[model samples]
Target: MAGKTINPTRMELTRLKAKQKTALRGHKLLKDKRDGLMKQFMQEVRRTRQLRKRVEEGLAQANAAFTVASAVMSPEMLEQALMAPRLSTEVTVDQRNIMSIAVPVFHRAEQEAQPDLACYGFAQTSGELDDALQALNRVYSDLLELAQAEKTVQLLAQDIERTRRRVNALEYVVIPENQRNIRYITMKLEENERGNTTRLMKVKDMVLQDAHHYKS
Candidate 1:
């Protein structure tokens, strides 16, 4: 399989050597990138786990508070109180590169000034409803952070897979093939040189014999 399509010459050998060197260098760089990405991915996974737990607990508390409030207050009154929301928020998305992977960053962009959770009058709403709203509000930042961390993990995983494939191709396929081709070309050139030297020696001996015969 070696040098089947390759020219067995010194020029071809030199070219293959240069190509092998480049492949090896690229393989090393990609391996480093993969390692760095794995490190960042693991850190992001840990952070996402923590944020998810916090968000879940906060949501559970809020749900319990809402249940209590619903039981104590009339349905009509509760519905009326929550009909109009006083706060408006927007989310701003940005990206940062980690090991050449672009990952999302989320920011809680408020359309209006930050306002209290109490959208309704205290006299009209139960304390339980206030607690529920406060609990939900507290988890918003963590929810955003969790989203960001999870997205980062996803992006890192994809880039790592891509880099791994390239490394494998160079290590298992490209480098070895080039090395075989180089050896084939070198052997062929050496054989040709030996053949030429043998022929030159034969010619020299024949010339000495002919000159001696002419002298006799």
Candidate 2:
């Protein structure tokens, strides 16, 4: 069975209004997502550069320490010393979202220094060798952070891409489709209005003619 025809003006106005509201909302959300992604991407890039530089500097210092230690301490002795008591460390991870993109929290583990491993006095080992080993350990921690950060960046980048695709689809496909439906509905409503108007005019004319004939 055919459904009752809706009033053209009211139906068209309602549909068009809804379409406009939805389109505006979608546009704002998509723009915010795009902006947030760009900002995060730039931040991560800068962090990667700085971390790489620090890690390299740490590696160089460690090489120097190992060389100096080799002169006085046998490799076996140093190894044995290193194998002694170990300091415990914990790494904490936190997660947050930036415009639907996930950000990873990275932390490094800390350790107590044993400068005497180099066969030097506590004071002697505390200076260069300790600093070097600390730096080396820090570099290792940074490498781990770098790995996590890179993985996070990759995932975020992928999300940005996926969101862009969805935004585009909404802008071009879904909105356009709704708009077309609105247009089609509007046309039908207008046609229905005109048909109603013509019918009413004819009925009025027929009633007038009948009255005129009866009065004559």
Candidate 3:
């Protein structure tokens, strides 16, 4: 007796072929998404680096301005000067979606300074007060932007990680299983075809022998 026989039905081969085709298409689509995600991640990394550099520069400037403003000006006058530069900050934050990730977008927070002559009433030059105020305000703005950029980059990094895992699963697990199943079904069908051919030949030979005996 045959150890085991596969069914010779055409349905098995047809189904296997269909599965293979579907797997191939899915594999290609996943690979494309992985590539696109990587590109977006790289771009965000570059922006993060540039923003960090800018923030450091702004901090240095603010520190220098504060030191000089304190040494050359009186506490009352300097306090007045600082208060004059007080800003009314209004932030309009929105989110930008890239590869299904929402990144923060800050529309240059609206800033307004209270103009008071009493704040500028000091022995220090107008240029010096103006310079210090500008430096301090720029530093504050830079810090805010850096925070947003850093947060955006961190979120994008996570997305890249998640996408990579999915890419690996499809490439290594799903498609390979489909291919293996298809191969097994194809071999089973071929084996069944050979066995059926052999049975047909044997039946024909037996019929011929019976006819010869009758003729005799």
Candidate 4:
């Protein structure tokens, strides 16, 4: 939109045309990248939704069983039963690339094969406690799956946002600006060419008039 900064010449027009071509190519590539990221992001979002629902339902069941157990058992007995944990889980953190974004992956490290939750004697503890422990164990893998899906969704969201911005920049700003510049340069070059041709024609007319007068 600003005034042209360079001299109006064929070379300048040529350079601007080349730049426009390159900008168009870059814009197309960015659009494709944005589309791909969107597809991946949508898939992750769906997976996260499903995993969250499953985890929530599992947690609710476990909590209800725990409440029943707490009410059924004597305070001292409940406290004693829960005083120690029977299972220890270790999680390993790593990263995997998705759509050029690094997403965290969590996996349980090597551990004793699914140990029993018999931290307290069954005679002292209510059956509700056993039910609650069983419910928790059943959902353990689902909880891990939910965590992985949520983290993946987060990373994909960030990547999609970044890609969208880039696409917008190329589509709305860079490519258009290059095109405008190219048009401006071409118009100026054509105007200058017409002016030079007019001046040359006027010079020829003057030369011809002078030669006719000398002959007379």
Best by TM-score: 1
**Candidate 1 all-Cα RMSD:** 2.5
lDDT-better candidate, 1 vs 4: 1
Residue-wise lDDT of candidate 3 within 80-115, one digit each (tens)? 655644456677889998877888987665554645
Candidate 2 or 3, higher lDDT? 3
lDDT per residue (tens digit) for residues 56-166 in model 2: 787888888777766666666566545654455577787877666667776765564553333333532325456656667667887777777777678778877887887
Give candidate 3 regions above 4 Å deviation: 1-12, 70-85, 111-113, 116-132, 214-216
TM-score of each: 0.91, 0.70, 0.74, 0.88
Model 4 has an lDDT value of 0.81
What local distance difference test score does each model get? 0.87, 0.70, 0.71, 0.81
Which structure among the candidates has the greatest lDDT? 1
lDDT of 4 by residue, 148-201 (tens): 888888777787788788878878887777677777777877788899999999
True-vs-predicted CA distance for residue 170, candidate 1, Å = 0.7
Determine which window of 10 residues in candidate 1 has minimal summed lDDT. Answer: 110-119
Candidates sorted by lDDT, descending order?
Answer: 1, 4, 3, 2
Ranking the candidates on TM-score from highest down gives 1, 4, 3, 2
Instruction: Determine the C-alpha RMSD for candidate 4 after optimal superposition of all C-alphas.
Output: 2.5
Q: Model 3 misses residue 179 by how many Å?
A: 1.1
Off by over 4 Å in 4: 1-7, 113-115, 212-216
List clash counts for every candidate, in order: 0, 0, 0, 0
Show model 1 residue runs off by greater than 4 Å. Answer: 1-3, 111-115, 214-216
Residues 99-125 of candidate 1 have per-residue lDDT tens digits of 667788899976543366577788878
